[model samples]
Target: MFGSLGAVTLLVSAVLGQGFATPKANGTSGYELKQGPLDTPWTEKVGTTPWPEYPRPQMARSEWRNLNGVWQYRNASGGESEMERPPFRQELESSVLVPFCLESALSGVMGNYTIHSWYRTTFNVPDSWTERVLLNFAAVDYQATVFVNEKQVANHTGGYWAFNIDITDQLNKNGTNELVVFVFDPTNLWPYNVPIGKQKLIPEHIFYTPCSGIWQTVWLESAPADSIEKLHINAGADGKVDITVHTTSNTTTTADFILYEPNSELVKLKIKVPVNKAHSFVVDSPQLWSPDSPTLYNITVKLGSDAVQSYTGFRTISKGVVNGVQRPLLNGEFVFMFGTLDQGYWPDGLHSPPSFDAMVSDLKVLKEVGYNMVRKHIKVEPALFYQAADQLGLMLIQDMPALSTSSVFINDETAKQCPGVSLTPSLDPDTVQKEFDRQLAVMVNQLKSYPSIVTWVIYNEGWGQPWEGNDGVRNTSIDGILTDYVRKIDPTRLIDSVTGWHDHGAGDFYDNHHYSSPQCGTPWYSTPSSPYNSETDHRIAIQGEFGGIGQNVSEEHAWKVAASINAINNTYELDATPKIWNLRAHMILQELEFQIQEYACSGAVWTQTTDVEGEVNGMLTYDRRVNRMDKDMWRRDIQGLYEAAARRARTNGTMGVEGRGGGGG
Candidate 1:
C-alpha cells in the first residue's frame, strides 16, 4: 500500500538515476554556513528529519511524506554547461535543508545575492498509490521550475503563494524517482515588481536581509482520484456556519461533518452536506469567540474514503458609531484593539519560523504582556499562525507585502525634514498591479475563513504600490478601486487601504504613524479633516505605528542581533538599563491611558514584536531570550488601560441601539 513503504525503498537517489551525481565534500566549494545564536530543543533533532510536523495543520491528512532534509544543491551562472540542468548531469556542489531560505544560516548555504540555484531529491511510490499523487510546495521565492523523471512538470511565479502539481504520470513506481527544482530570485532587482516586504539589496536599520528558494515546507500527498481539493468554513455571530467543499469529481458528492467542542470535549452534532455548495447550520446557545474567551469547533469532513480535519470560531467583525465616534464592533459590541507590529522574521529562519512552538512562544509572550491584537505587517504568514490566533483569542490586522524596486522611508522627522517628498509612491512597473491583484485574491481566498482576522491592510508607508497623479497630486482613485474589489470578495471584514501615509480618504480607518520623542501623545481631529484634502467622514482614526525605543542588550546574549548591519561599527551604547527601561515602559503605559481616555482613537499598534537586524526597538531581543521592557509594569499598568478603554466604549450610551450579535450583512 502507499501508506507503507517497502524495505526495497532506496534512501538515496544514486540508484534511481544512472547520471545522478553525489554531493561535493563539505567546505570544498559551497559558501561558509553558520548557525544563529539561539536554538530550540527541536533544532538539534533536525538531521535527516527536519520539520517532520505536518505543514498544513488546518486542513490535514494522515498519509503524507515530509521532504525537508538533505537535498543536493548547485549554484550556476547563465554561461554554465547544459549539464547543469536537471536529472543529474554532474555532482552538485553542496547540500542544504529544504524549507529554509538560502540566506539563512540553517539552510547550510549562507550565501548572499545568489540569483540562481538547483535542488535534487528522490522518492519512491508504492503500487497502491497509482491513482494520483500531488506534489505541494508551500512557498518558493521569485521564480521556480520543476522537473520529474527528466520531464518538465510545472513552472510557477510569485513568492508568497503556494502551488501544487499532479505528478502521478511522471513517477516511477518500482524505483526511486528523481525530482529537480530550479529557482531564481531577483530580490529588489530591476524590472521585476515582486512583493518583497522590508527586504533590501543593502541591509540597513529597518529593512533587513532577503530570502530565496524554498522557504517553506515541501511534501507529497496521496489521495483518491476524486477527493476534496479545498474546503471553506465561515462562522457568524448568529451561531450559523456556512461550509463549502470543492471536490475534484464533478458528480454529486455527499460529505459527512462531525462537530466537536475541543475545549469542552463534547460532541456537538453530526450532519451530511452536499459538495461544492453552501451548507448552513445554526447551533443552540453557541459559545462566541473573543479576547476573553476563545471557543473553537473541531470539524471533520469526509468524502468517500478521503477525510480532512479543520476548525472555526463563532464571531463577527464590523464598524459603527460609538459615543458619536466611529469604531470597530466585535460580535456587535464596541471593543478597543491593542496591537503590536509583528514583522514575522526569525533570527535563523528569516521568512519561516524556526518551529511551530517558536511561533507560539512569540504570541504567548505578547498575550502575557497584555496585547490582544497584532498587525501582521507586510507579510502573509502560514495558515497555522492565523489558526493559533483564532484559538488563542488574539485579533490580527493583515498587510499586503508591497512590490516594487523603490523604497518608502518614514520616521519621526519625515514630515518636518521632507515636506512634499515624503508622500510619493515608488516607481511602478506596468505588470505589478496585475500580479498584486492575483496574489491579493489568493491571500483572501486562503485566509478569509479565520475569525481572528478583522482587518486587511492594502499598503504600508507606500513602499511599492502607491498612487501618484500626472499633476503630482496625491489621490485615492486607485485605492478606491482596489478597496471596492476587496469588498466585493470579502465584505465581512473592514479594510485599511493605506496604513501610514498618502491617505486617499479611503478604507475604514484614519490610519496614522507617529514616532515623536515623547513616545506617548494622541491626536484629536475636531474638524475631521483628511491629510490630503477636506474633512474626512468614512473611517475611524487609529494610530497604526509608534514607539520605537532602541535598547542594545548585552553582547554575550545578543551577539548575532547586530551582526548583519553593524559588522564593523561596534560602538552601540547600552544606555537603556533596567531602571531606564522600566521608566520607558511607565511612560508608554501613561501614554496608552491618555490615548484611550482623552483621544478618540479606537486602536493602537506598537512599533514591533522583536528586534530584527540592526533595528533594536523591539520589545524582545532577536533570539527571544531577553525582554527589553518591564514586564511587571506592563501587566499592572498597560493591560488595565486596554480593559478600561473597552469598558468606556461599551457603556458610552450605544448599548442596545442595534442588535449586539448580528453578523456582517
Candidate 2:
C-alpha cells in the first residue's frame, strides 16, 4: 500500500511527536512541502541519524552509522565537479529531503532533472573509532558518483543494488566532513525503448511517473580494515548446507552454524577455519523449509576480533514427474505454488514506499489474501523488503527487471480490443548483453540468501527482446545463454528463461501467461475442435498471469478518471447498480479454479497484487487502502483448490514421485 503525502505527513508527526510542526513556506532550513501522496510529511521524518534498522538484519554487525535524512541538494549547472562549492551566488534553490526521489513531493523539489544533479551533506566521525568507515548507498538510480570530504570515493551504474566504498582513507578525523553525490539519469532524454516498466516522463496507459536520483536509504558503517565482507549460504536436502564467507582480512577464524526448528533445537556445529574459506556442516534430521510451515535456522559466525550473524534454511526445490506430469518439488515433494505478480509500486512514493512499514504492508496483504508466494515483477526491492518476506514466511519468485529492446503483446481477444498498444521490442545486442549481465549479477549476489526466493525469472514477455522474428514466429538463442548463466551463478534455484507469451522450451519450467479467461494450451486442455477448454500437454503447466478484471472504487481514486484496461471502459464503480464488477471478480476466481481442476496446473500467479499507476487491474487498489476482491472468499477458494489438487495427485497412484509430485510424509 502506498501512502499519500498527507497520510505520510500525519505518520511523521505521530512518530516524531509534538513541536515538529510543518515547515513554513519561506523558512530557510525548513523545506517547502510539496502537495502529493508521495510528498507527505512522514517522509521528511526519515532522519539522518537513526536511518533504517541497524545491523541490516540479513548481515548483522555491531558497529555502523546511519547516514539517511536531510541533505542539501542543488540542480547542477552541469559543470561543477567538486563537493564543496561556493554557495550559489543566486537565490538558494529549494532543499530536498534525502533518500526520496526528486520527483517525489516529499523531496521538497517535486520536479524532474533531465541533466545531472548534486547532493551535499556533512557528518562527524567518532573520535574513539580507529577503523575504516564505509559509505553505502542502498540504491542510486541510473548513474551515481560519490565524493567524501572533497575526494571522489566511488562510482556506480545500476539503480537497484547496493554499493559501498571505503571512505576512512579520505575522512577528516576530527571535524565534520562533507559528502556529495552526483547523479545523472536519462529518464526523459533516453529513447522510449529502454524497457522501463512503470516509469514514464509523461505517465499514461500503464506507464508510471519517473523516479530519479536516490530513491532508497543511504548510510555509513565502520569496520576493521580487514573484515568479513559477505556471506553466502546454500542449504540442500541432504541436511548439509555450505557457507561461503568473503572477507577482506586473511586471518584465521572460526565459523559456527546452528539449526533451529519451531521451538526446538535441531543442530549446532562450530568449526575453526581459515578466513574467506568455504565450510559445510551436516545436520541429522533437518527440518525442511516451506511456505506452509516456514522453518528457519539461525546461524552466527565469528571471525578473529569480529563476528556477524546470518541465517539459512535446510530445504531443496526440484522438478520431476507427478502422475506423469512435471511439477515443482519442495523438500522432495509436490507443493502447488500459488502466488501473484507483485509489481512493487506505491501510489504516493512512486518507486519508494513512504516507510518500511508500507512495504511490509503489501506483503502482509498478499499473505492475507491466501497467496503463499509472490513473483517480484521486474523491480528489485530494498533488502529489508526481502527480509520481511523471509521472516513473514512468504516464498518469492524474483524477476530480473526486463531489459533489452523487444516489444511484447498479448494476442487474446482482450488484447485485440487494444490494437497498436504493444510493448516495444528489439534491443542492441551489445547493450542487451551488458545490461543483462550487470543486472543479473547484482540480483543474484544480493538475493542469494533468505529462504523465500525459490525461482529467478531471466526475462519477461520479451520486453526489449531480440528474438528471431520470422512472420510472427519469435525464437531466441539468448534464452539458453541466460539460463546457463543463472544456473552457474546460483544452481539451487529454478530459472524461468522467458516468462509469458514467448516460450523457448529450454528453461526449467513451462511458463505461460493468460488474462481474463481460462484457455488450455496445445495438447493438454485443448484440441483442434475444443481448443479453449482443456489443459496443455506441457510437462508442467502454470497460470503465469490471469484475472485482470477491473473494479474501481471512485472515492478512493488518486487519479481523477478511471483508467482503461485493454483500451476499454471496462472500469466499473464499486457501488454501481448490481455491482457487476463484484460478480466479474467472483467469476474470474471461479474460472481460475475451473482451470486448475481441469488442467491440473501445478501453480498459478494472479495478474497482480496492487494497481500500478495506469494499470488499475490489481486485486488491491494502488494505495492498498481497499481490497477489490473479498478476502474470505479468496482464502476459501484457494484452500479448496489446494485440497482438491492434492487429492487428485494422491488418487492417481502418482504420490511421492519425489522428482515431481506428492507431499513428504
Candidate 3:
C-alpha cells in the first residue's frame, strides 16, 4: 500500500551540477547563526516549531502535532553509504532547526551542502490519538525516506508535492517512539532530468542557491481507519459549489457538510452526501469574491469520527471578447491584472517563509499598492501563502515549478545565464513524457482547490521545454498536450502554457517578458518573441514579465554573497539619483496603462516584487526592509491601470459602470 501511493506518482529526473567547497561540520552542538543582511520582524519568533500555524488551512484537522522543533542531524557526504544500520537511540552529531532547508541561515545548520543528511527525533503518540497515526511531510527537497522505530515506513520522491505515510502500525503505543528521516537532495545534480526551478548548487546571476532537505512543514495527523482523505471543491461565482470528498476506505461512506458565510459562524447551508461522490449547493444572493470585495464561505466536514474545516470563494475566471479582443474576465469583468513577479525567496529562510503572517503582510503590501494579482514565479509556495492571498483578495498566476532547461532559446538571452540550458532540444522519450504528464496532473489536482489561483503557468523561458524549440515546434508543442490535460482536470481556470520566449501558440494567453532600463520606451505597444502580432492574435496578450529596474537603496541590506552579479553589484542608481527606480516605475506603468488596450495587452507582471539573492531588479530590497517604490505613487499608478480597464469596459458596453469587479456582461 505504501509503494502503491507513489507508483502512479509522476517521476521527474535531474542532472548533477558542479560541486562547491563544503562547509566544515560542527557536530555535537546547537547551531549559532549570524545575523543575515537583514531579518524579518518574525525572525526572532522562530522556535522549536517555527511555523506553528495549522499546516493545512483549507483542510483543518484539530488533532495534529507539529514535529518541527530541533532535531539531531548528521551529514553523510555519500548518500546511503552508511545504510548498514539506521542511526537509532544514539546522538550522531549536531542539532538543527526543522522545516528550513539545510543551506539556509535560519536552520542553524548554515553548513555544508552535502548530498545526504540524516535526522532523528523522538515523540510519544497520545493515547487519545486513536484509530490510525499518520506522518505527513509537507514537502522534502529531492528525496525522503522515513523510519519509525528503525522500521522503514515510507519513502517519497519529489521536492514540491506533499505526501503522507501511515505510521499507525509502526507507532509505539506505550513509550516514546523514535523517528528518523534520511533525506537526499541532489538539487540540479540528479542523474535524471528533475524540476529544480531557478535553484542551482552554486549561486550565481539569475540562479540562486539551492534548497535541500526538508523545506516545508512536517507534522502528524490522526484519523479513523476509514476517514476523509481529501476534498475537491469547484466553486462558481453564481453562488454554486460542487464538492467531492475522497475517503481512505474504498467502500461508500457518508459525509455531512456545513457551510458558514464570510464573517458569520452561523451555518448557511448543510448537506450529507456519499463519500467520493460530488454534490452541488447554491447560496442565494451570494456576495461574490472579487478583487474589490473578497468574500469566502467557511465549511466544516464530518465523516463519522473524522472531521476537517475548509474554506472557498466564489469567483469566475474566463476568457471573453471585450471590444473585439480577448481578455481575462474576473467575476464577468475585465479586472486588469497589474502585478509583480514574486520569487518567494528570503535571505534568512531561503525557501522556507519567515512566518505565515509575514507572507500575509507581503500580500498586504502589494494590495496597498493597488495591485490585484501576483505571479508566483517558478516555485510552489506552502498553503499559508495561498491562504493569505484568498483572505486579502490577491489573485495569483501560479507557475509550475520549471525543470532545468534543455535546449538553447533562439531569442531569449536569459537562457545563456541559466545553468543546464545548453543541452540539445528534443522530445522526451514516450515513457519519460508519460511520467512528466502524470506528475503535472497531480500538481494541478493538489492546488486547484484554492480560490486565489486564477491561472496556471505551464512553463517559463522554455527552460525544460527543449522539445518546443525555436518557433516552438508549434505542431508538436508538448504545452498543447499538457494544457489539455490541465483543462480536463480543472477547466474553471485559465492556462498560460508559455510565459516567455519560444511560444508554441499553446494555452489561452500569449505573453512575453520585456526588460530594459527605465529610460527606454516600455509598457508601449511592443512584445518581443511573440508567436503572433498582438493586433491579430485571438488569445489574450499580456506582458508576463517587465520592469527589471534594478536598484539598491541601502548597500547594507543587500546580499553579501560573492557572485559575478548580485544585487549590490548590479545597482541601477547612484548617490545622485536615489529615487530614479521608483519614479521610473510609476512612469513605465502609466505608459503601460495608456497603451494597454490599444496594444491588445490585457495584463502585465513587473519583473519582481522583492530582490532575491543575485537579481537586483525588484521594487523591494532583498532584506525586505526598504520599499524602493513609494507606496502612494505606486498605488496611484496601479489605480490608473484599473480605471482605464473599467472605462474601456463601460465604453464597449461590456460591463456595469460601478468600476472594478462590476459584471462585464
Candidate 4:
C-alpha cells in the first residue's frame, strides 16, 4: 500500500536527484546555503535554541518538551495523496527548522510553496514521560491537519493562534513515532476561505510578504493525567486579582498562588478549591499599571503535581471625567500614552525574528527611544513578544491584523496594486461580521492576559474598510461595530475606533494620523472638514501616526544599490546621500515637540521604528543595524515633551480641548 514502507522507498529514490542533499549534522549550515539577503547565516549557531527559554513566558511550565528542531518535510503535489505514494519523498532533500515559517529565510527553505503541502517527522517517546502527552503548535498559518503514526489527530484553521492535541494513546513507546502535518493556505487569491490579514503571495508595497506553514514554536509537554488545562488571571483596581484555574480532573485540589513584584520576593497564598472552579485573590495596595509606569505582578500556581507560572497587573482602564472632561484613566489617574507604530518584521526572518534576542532587541530599542507604548501594527506576534513588553514594562496598543478592502485614500497606484483581490470585502456584511468576530475574538483571546496591551486599535486608517463615502458622508456606525467588538471581548482596554480617517465620534479618545505635518486641531470644528483634516472637540486627542522622515545610513541598508548623493538638488539615493540628515531630524523633533508642547497631544506613534520594504520612513533601517536620527536628542526631547504635556493635562484638570492650544492635524 502507498501508506506503508513504499513511501519511504520512493522518498529515498527521489533524494538521489541533483537538488537533493543529505541533512547536515549541524542544522545551521543549511540556512547559510539558501539564496537572497533575506537568507543569511541564521543557522550558524545551533543546539541552544536561543528561544528555548520557554516559549510561553507569561504561562510557565516546569515539565514540557521542546520540539523546536529539525523536522522532515516533503512537497505535496496535491489531492488525495498518501504519504507512502510513489512521488512521496523524505530523504532530507530539505529539513525545515521548526518554530520558523517555511516562507521565512531562517527556515533554510526560503522558497514559496503552493497552498497545500505535506510534512512528516518522526521521534521516539522519552521513557521518563509516563503521563499524557500534549502536542502543541504555537501557530500554523491558515489551516492544518495533524496526524500521528498515519492516524489523524487534530486540525486547526487560524494562522495566528495556538492549538494542541493529546496523543498519549497514539504514541509508540518502543519504536520511532511518526508525526505528519498537512497545511493548506489559499491566501494568494481574493476572498480566501479563511480570515487572513495583509498576506500576499507577491511581496510589495505595504503588504510586505506572506508567512505560511509553522511560524511559531512547536513543542510537546507531558502533564499529569489530571493537570491544569488552562488558566485566566484578572487584575482589577479594587485590589482583587481574580484567577480561574481549569483542570481536567473533577477532584478537589489544594491550589497555591504566589505574586511577585519586579525583581522582588514572591508573595505566596494557599487555598483549597474544587478543580476547574474559579478562584479569586485580593492584593492590597496593588501596583497600578499604566503607560507612564507599567507594573506587572508575577504569578505562580500549583495544583497537586502541576505547577504553572504567569503574570498580571493590577490596573483599571476606563473613560472618566477629569476636571469635568472625560479622559482615559489608568488606575484612576489620567496619563498620556506615547508609542511607535511597530510592524514586527525582520529583514532576515520576515514575520519571524531570528531569535528571541532579536525580538527583545526591537522592544529594547523602542524603550530606548522613550516610547512608553507600541502600537503592534496589524500583525499579531508570538506570545513571548508581548511577554518581553510585560516584563520590560512597555505599554501596548494592539491592532487586529486587518482583512478587508484597501483604503480609498491610499495613493491610486497603491490602491490598484493592493486591493481586495483575495479578501472578504466590507460590502459582504455577513462575511464582514463573521470575519470581524472571528479575528477580533482570536486577537483578544490570544493577548488579553498580557497587562502590556492597554489599548486596542480596531481599525487602522480605514485600510480594510471605507469609513467615508464617496459623497464625503462619514459612516461612524461601520467603525462602531469594530470598536464595540473589541470592547465586548476585552472591556478593560481603550479603543482607537478609527485610527486614521473618518471621525466616528466613537471610541474613548480622538485618534488621528498625519504624515506630512504635526498640526493639532481644535476640540470641535465649527465647519465640518475632511475626515483626515477635521478637528474634534469633547475628547482627549492623540497623534496616532506621524513623522515618516527617512535618513539612509550606509551600512544598515540590505539592498545592493550603491549609495548616491545629489547634494545640489538635495536628492539622496543609494550612493551620494543627501546631507539633509540633520534637517530631517530637526523637522521630526520640532514637529513632535509642537504636538506635545503646543497641542498637548496625549501621545504619538512615529511613522515606524524600522523601514518596511520600500517605505523607508523608519527611525532605523530595516536590518535594525542603524539609527538615522539622533537617539539621545530625540529621547530627551520626547521625554521632556511628554512630561510637560502630562503636567499641563494634570494642571488643567481636563482632557485638552481642540482649539485650546494644541497644533497639527
* Whole-model lDDT per candidate: 0.70, 0.64, 0.72, 0.63
Number of the top-ranking candidate, with lDDT as the measure: 3
Give lDDT tens digits, candidate 4, residues 142-184: 7888888768899887788888888989988788777788877
**Candidate 1 RMSD to the correct structure:** 8.5
* Number of clashing pairs per prediction, in order: 0, 30, 12, 28
Task: Please give, for residues 31-128, the per-residue lDDT of candidate 3 as tens digits.
Answer: 55546655766687775557766667677776777777777788864457656567887775877777888888788787545468888878777777
Candidate 1, which ten residues in sequence have the lowest lDDT sum?
1-10
lDDT computed for candidate 4: 0.63
Clashing residue pairs in candidate 1 are: none
TM-score to true structure, per model: 0.85, 0.83, 0.87, 0.82
Cα lDDT for residue 233, candidate 3 = 90
Give the alpha carbon lDDT tens digit for every residue of 1-665 in model 1.
01111101121112221121223445434423467654443454455445555666556765666677667776645412433546453446688777788877777786666567788777776565646788888889868888888888999987888888889889887888888888887666544457888876456566667888888878887877788888888788998888888888775768998788654436787888899887888877778889888777777789888887667788889998876567788999878788789999887778878666777788888888778899998888766678678867899999988875453332222112211122223446445677788888778877888888999988887665544547756545878888888988788899998887776678898787766221122333222223421133557767787666566666654536444547423323223565665566566656656556654568888877987777666778777877776677667665666665675565642221221221110
* By lDDT: ranked, best first: 3, 1, 2, 4
Superposed model 1: Cα runs more than 4 Å off: 1-45, 79-84, 87-90, 126-130, 264-266, 405-428, 516-536, 557-575, 650-665
Candidate that scores best on TM-score: 3
Which candidate do you rate higher for TM-score, 1 or 3? 3
Greater-lDDT candidate between 2 and 4: 2
